[model samples]
Target chain A: MKSTWMMRAFALASLFMAGSAWAEVVVKIGFAGPLSGPIAHLGKDEEYGARLALEDANAAGLTLGGEKVRFELVAEDDQADPRTATTVAQRLVDLGVRGVVGHVTSGAAIPASRIYDQAGIPHVTPSATSPKLTQQGYRTSFRVIANDLQQGTAMARYAADTLKLRKVAIIDDRTAYGQGLADAFAEAGRKLGIEVVGREFTNDKATDFMAILTRVKARQPEALFYGGMDPQGGPLLRQMRQLGMNTQFLGGDGACTAEMLKLAGPALKEGAYCTQSGLPKTKMPGGEAFFARFKKRFNMDVQLYAPYSYDATNALIQAIKTAGSADPARYLPALQTIRFNGITGPIAFDERGDVREGGVTLFRFENGAWVAVP
Target chain B: MDILLQQIVNGLVVGSVYALIALGYTMVYGILGLINFAHGEVLMIGALTALQTLGVLERIAPDLGPLAQLAIALGVAVPVCMTLGFLMERLAYRRLRNAPRLAPLITAIGVSFLLQTVAMILWGRNYHTFPQLIPTTPLEPVSGVFITPVQITIVVVSALMMAGLLVLVNRTRLGRAMRATAENHRVASLMGVDVNAIIGATFVIGAGLAAVAGVMFASNYGIAHYAMGFLPGLKAFTAAVLGGIGNLGGAMLGGIVLGLVESLGAGYIEHLSFGFLNSSYQDIFAFIILGLVLIFRPTGLLGERVSDRA
Candidate 1:
């Protein structure tokens, strides 16, 4: 009788959990990113893109095995810290989410991915491009953005072919994301026959780079590439200008933001180069209406990563509709088959779950705006 | 040889800034016989004041020359910082003067938190680029060395400030009074030295110097934020202790020596052997130096007799 009671109690607890989770017909997807920091704009933009996809998918009436299903979105702020990412991931798991769409920046995503992997949940990153994130070969992890290899190569090519840089200086914030991008760029620059002159490292919270700048000015590299976000990048730009380092800077999408321009001061933005994924404002895919609605809803400017996030969430929703089940293991193959066209260009995934037909645009800070490379 | 020379130049520029900030911490300690743990926060406030002034000036006249902008910053940061320094002493430190030493230490910590929270609430949790005052171009003609005008300015200005301080402490009446108060406050009070007035003046002067250092640091770095003072504060304290806590000269020497050791340890010495040390561990080196100094000579390089004894 005691054994029977224990079994029954365990069964009841699971049933309660399942019952509560399945109580809602909506398919819930979890999103995570640093929503409040130096690089928060990227996370904010990603949230935007995900929100649009959700609205459109819900309007289209999601289906699973020809049955109607609803979709819901849940977002958490990781604040760009690794430990916080783990905590947020656990919260989503405890909430019984079917799938997740973030853990932006490899620093946060690397630690958080472990929780989802153990729980057998599918997580797709739209913006995190760190090579190590995928090098571990986790089945649960996916990224829609091109990795450091792609962006780094593009950065090198731009410097050598277009910018005509013969030598360049490199600085990294020593984060997995920053270091990864910088290493890739340095390797690519070397292969392109561009001289890699000076290399420097800084901490995440460091604001002063004068000593480093003074050193860089001495080297007189034709260009500088800083692999960090707006907080560090903006100040570096301003200091470079103040220090009279006339060389242009080429950085990843991490430095591409209104916040960066504002932080660097308007004058310093001139002659800087940045590479970001997807379409520019004029060339957005089904983005004309999205931009208008985003501005109206958020009452602020739209950011770069929001489009990718929208696609990631919408793609997950579409997959759940086709699979007709919340079990990601059984349902994720349908997601792997995600070929639907959505915001930030058409959304699709390869064997590694990276975006198939994606490339980064090399943009320059001209006047006060980021202009696509001519 | 060239790399080593370059690194030395780097250390000197950085060391001078460290010296200026360290003096502020030491002076406050010398006067009150208590560690003003909020000294770092005082530096943060100075940066914010300069930032606000720059913003207002830039908006009012975008074409204003850099010199004009700097003038505006001086006007804004000076009055604001002096008032802040005076008010903080009166409101926070004054009441706890007669309390146990630990109480004032605790109050200083609370004041640090209060200042940090106020900064966060007002500035929003984001990175704002602080205006740059110094030109960052590298200076040449040293043949084997690469240095910048800004670095030279740092060394020169810091040395000059330290010199001025020495004269102020040794050659002036207020200095005499301050030294007497620090030596024995009750006795000094009996002697009509106006103990309260001296303490208040000490805070104001220390804050003014910190403001100048804050501006220099921000201008060099190109940005400032709410949490800027945390690490630097800890480093300045270590400098004070390493130099022999109660001595002004010791603090300046300690700061420069610490900077030189770290830069050389990382740049030249790190690669010499099995590759244990590097620039990344430069911060760690400072603490190690401090620990060694404490273990060997806790009173610091100089005697801890109050400034009056010197």
Candidate 2:
């Protein structure tokens, strides 16, 4: 009698589980970035941000088309390589991910954007800032951050108007993002009457910059602008100091990271400046609460792009809710015209799928941290 | 003129580390006729081990002097790398001694990849800032030219080590046994030279040099990562081949010459290419020289012993 009673309880539990599973619809969102490399910390930050957003969405217990919905995140490592990005994108598509929030570096995102477009899956990039990504006119490609043009213009304006710098040199790591930002900065600097004394290029994997710095030093520019991430930027600044250049240093969002302060160490001084693609975190709409919650969840401080990533993931989910379907075909239009207030700010995409009202902020290294220049 | 001097100084510092690593490749090739492709990974292991030691030293003895801490780290790294080298020879190369040449070469590559993967798991993918035990403050040895104390240390230390190695090989009784083993293992064994011991000693000595080179490389650049050894390792291999794979003096000379060529190439590539290219083409100079050397002087500079042995 006891055995029969236990068997009946097991049968009832299994039936309940089956019924619930049938009633709930599982939706997968893909996230791809460099998860194992020098810049992996930044990639992981973005992934965790997306994860938190999904967790929050799941907890809200929303119903889509009268069925309870569940959200799942599928992550892939692209290693920040363009070739690997395409393969990861195809893999995500094959895995039936309804949408993607990924390909952090512009080099990876631009190439992977073609894959998502071909597969008819929409992808929103949280950190990639190269203008060409959206210029390609792919309906599936959307960006939630300010492009390189805005960042470069803001930096050049600050350099000319505020710092009153007359001449500067430029260096790039030769990735799509680096080169694009460097070119945009050069163009804007010319318009602002700031002479670009020199331009040099290096690869993303390089650690040594003595040779190039020596060449740039000969030009004797008052300031130097480097368009690359912190990995290269840190060493470059150190080498520049070693060469005794003592010139002011400027960089874009790629180098405007908390990691830069640690990597550059003592070389990052008062003269070092960078431009981030959005307002400072303290100025964001829900910045304080987000920071406390993020720290509680991950036991780490937010890196550069986490807030934007969180907003992008939420934007996708919001679109799915408005469309009342998880199908990419059903939600693509909704995503294109979606409007919502995000942790970063108000979010709405324009005709080219670039985020509207995107703002840029300038920061300077002060007291060993990036301080907003106001 | 000042720019030229700075580039040359930079080249010499980088070349010294390459020469040190190349010695390991050359010595192993001389004795066992093996390229020891994983030799670079040994250098990487040495650097990371030193970095790990430094971390522990910081926690346990935070008040230690920088130089003393560095010495302790090197002391630990050298022995660890030596044991690793001996184990690699005993377990991997000894069994493949009679296999086809391609087999050992492939095995060396596999071992290299394995070491990198293992390092990745242990250290994770973040680039650790190698503590600058030696101060990086620049000193102007000449007007308009900057040289850091770390650079001077690298050059001076590499020269001392290379000179010591030369004396050991040329003057010691054990060196005589090593030379005998390299000439003919079967004949050396018949003559009671203890061929196995000499080969093992060769790997140990090479690994010791690699450890020093690895530490110096990280110190000069101020960063350490798992994949840091690949490029330097390949370049050092090119140096060994360029200097004549079996020759010690040739390895040193090839490394310095290659470094100079790369630095000068990067410094002037813009003017040479009429602005069509930049210093990003710096890596091309090494391969170009390697190609030219292989085509014209297959025996390499100072390479009289390679053809006679094999």
Candidate 3:
């Protein structure tokens, strides 16, 4: 009598769980980024993008495998530290999230990718641009943004061909993103026969670059390329101007943002160029409507990676719908082969899990804003 | 030669700010035998407050001239920082005065972090572009090397403040009281000096110096943020120790020397390191000098003053 009752109780519990699963599925999508530290602004920006995507998808009544699904964002703060990133990734995986949207910086993303790869979860980074991220050969790891290779080549070509500049000085912050972009720029500049003059490095925490600027000034390069984020880029620009070395300044996506303008202020001059990884917002598919909706929902302007992050979330959800299930293992293959038009562009990953034909848009700091270089 | 001269000029400008900040560290250490780790946060607070004041002024009085705006910002920053310093001593440091030395040291660190978090929430984490009141026109007193008006102002202003500080510490009745307290707080108390009030005054004066230094730093660098204080503060502490902790003249001398070493060392590090290290490794100069000074002369360059002799 006791055994029969126990069996019946177990059966009833299973039935209730199945019923709930049938009624509605809550799919958790993980997001890991620096939410609390110095780079928290960028992480928060991407998180908001994912949040908006989730809200829109649920409001539209997303259905996967004939079950109405509510997409949930499980945002984790990696603090932009690589070690913390791995822990965050494991935590998200343990939480049984179907997919992930970010570990914003290349430094954090590279290490976190291993954790996601082991868990067999589809992880999409919206903003990390190191070419090595995809080169790791992880089947589940993918990026929505163009890698540094494209950015660096474009920057080099712009310097050599568009501006007709030959000599360039390179300064990197020595992080994965900064150094990788600088290395790529140097390689491309060398290939184009432009003189790669005075390659220097500073750490990310540094505020002083006068010594490096002075050295770069002595070399008298026609252009200065800094591969770092806005904080360092801003001060470097100011110091460069102070040293009276008014060279054409070029940088990769790290230095290309609205915040850069605020940080650099009057130091930002015309003819300063930067390359971002996607098409201009106006040029993206359904970008204008999305931006309008985003502003209405969040009451803030989109920072650098919001559109890409929005697309990343949508693409993950689309893959779930395509696979007819929210299980990461079941949907990941669908994600690999998924072809969907997204806010940024047509979202399709190549075999290496890099966005196919990822676009690079050139921008110039003009009239106190970043304007597309016509 | 021109590059050397230019780096020296840069060093001196930076060093003067260090001297101003170091004076605060030395003064507090002299009187209380405490490190006052939050001294750097005091600098950060001053800069951020001034920036906020300038922001308000810009919005309310767009037609205000840059000089007037600067004067008003400084006027606001100094008093606010003075109050912050006073409150810090009263609330955080004063309680731990009789505790184990380690207790106060840890509390100082905790106070530093607390201030950073508060400032971060208040000002946001991103670097705000501090308005440039001083023109950045390069004045070439020497060929092939350029110095901005801002740099000159930093040097001149720091020099004037240091001179004024020397006069205050040596001439006034308050100065005598401060010196007596630093020499022997218990004896000075017995001699009718208000030991607590003098300590508070020392913090206020140091905070005032920090406010000016903070403004100069932000103005010279053209950006300001919450974390901006940590590095300058650490370097300034080094300057204080290097100059002999309790000596006013030593603090100024130590700051300039350290600055010159950093500037010249950064310019020549690549050659010195046989092409391995470069200007990017400029931070190493401070640590190296600090280590060398601690090893060779524990009492510091000018010699430390012992407040209590058992």
Every model: iRMSD: 4.0, 1.1, 1.6
TM-score of 3: 0.93
**Tens digits of lDDT, candidate 1, A233-273:** 88778667655567888888888777778777744646689
- Residue pairs in clash, model 3: none
Segments in model 2 whose C-alpha atoms lie over 4 Å from true places? A1-21, B305-310
**What is each predicted model's overall lDDT from 0 to 1?**
0.78, 0.91, 0.88
* lDDT of model 2 at position B118: 94
User: Model 2 misses residue B275 by how many Å?
Assistant: 3.3
Docking class of 1: acceptable
What fraction of native interface contacts is shared by candidate 1? 0.31
lDDT per residue for candidate 3 within A1-374, as digits (tens), equals: 99999999999999999998879988999999988765778898899999998888899997766778988999999988889999999999999998999979999999999999998988899999999999999998999889999999998988888898888999999889999999999999899989988888888877777777777787889999999998889888988888887898998887898878887778889879999988888889878998888888889888778899998998898898888888888989999999988889899999999999689999988889999886
Candidate with the greatest lDDT versus the true structure: 2
Look at candidate 2 and give me any clashing residue pairs: none
Error of 1 at A42 (Å): 4.0
lDDT of 1: 0.78
Per residue, candidate 3 scores C-alpha lDDT tens digits across B1-310 of 7777777777887788898899899888887888999999999999999999999999999999988999999999999999999999999999899888899889999999999999999998777889889987677657778889998899899999999989998999889999999888899999999999999999999999999999988988888888899989998999998988888888898899888888778788998899988766877887798789878987678856842411
Candidate 2's error at A132, in angstroms? 1.5
Query: lDDT: which is higher, 2 or 3?
Result: 2
- Per-residue error (Å), model 3, residue B302: 2.4
User: In model 3, what is the error at residue A252, expressed in angstroms?
Assistant: 1.1
